[model samples]
Target: MTIDEQTVDKIAHLARLELGAQEKQDMIADMNKILGFMDKLNEVDTTGVEPLIYMTDEPNTLREDVIKQEITTAEALSNAPDHDGSHFLVAKVIK
Candidate 1:
């Protein structure tokens, strides 16, 4: 497919972009080049190629989930610069 100035203008507007005349012309040429490249790619034959999901052959390596030491509430709140005994305190945000 060929890209024209009108198409470039419409695309720029949709993208919320302000393009000058030179930039619009450049975009039109660039888009046409990309479309031409895609068209060339379409001419390639891939009759029995399997779609690739993963790039590597290695399987997922994960460690077993295990619980470790758990700290008490008082221990957790000990280092807080501002806290209301149970929870950390912060400045009010909502109006």
Candidate 2:
């Protein structure tokens, strides 16, 4: 399919883009070239080629999950900028 100025204008409008007359003409030419290349690609024969799913053959590796000791309340609150004994304090967000 060939791209024309009208098609370029429609595409630009749909994409919310502002293009000048020269830019619209340039875009039409560029789009036509791209479509021409795609048309050439369509001429290639691939009768029995299997569609690719994954690029690599290796399976995903996973690590075993193990139970671990949880940090104490004091340890968890150690990095707080302002804390009231066991809980963090912050400025009131609601009126």
lDDT of each: 0.90, 0.90
- Per-residue lDDT for 58-85 in model 2, tens only? 9978989988869988998899999998
TM-score against native, each model: 0.62, 0.60
Clash pairs, model 2 backbone: none
Candidate 1 C-alpha lDDT tens digits along 1-95: 69998888889989999999899888988999999999999998978998889999899999999988699778989999899899988889998
TM-score of 1: 0.62
**Candidate 2: misplaced stretches above 4 Å?**
61-95
Global lDDT of model 1 = 0.90
- Please give the RMSD to the true structure for each candidate, in Å: 5.9, 7.5
Reference-based lDDT, residue 81, model 2: 93
- Candidate 2 has what TM-score? 0.60
| lDDT at position 95, candidate 1 | 85
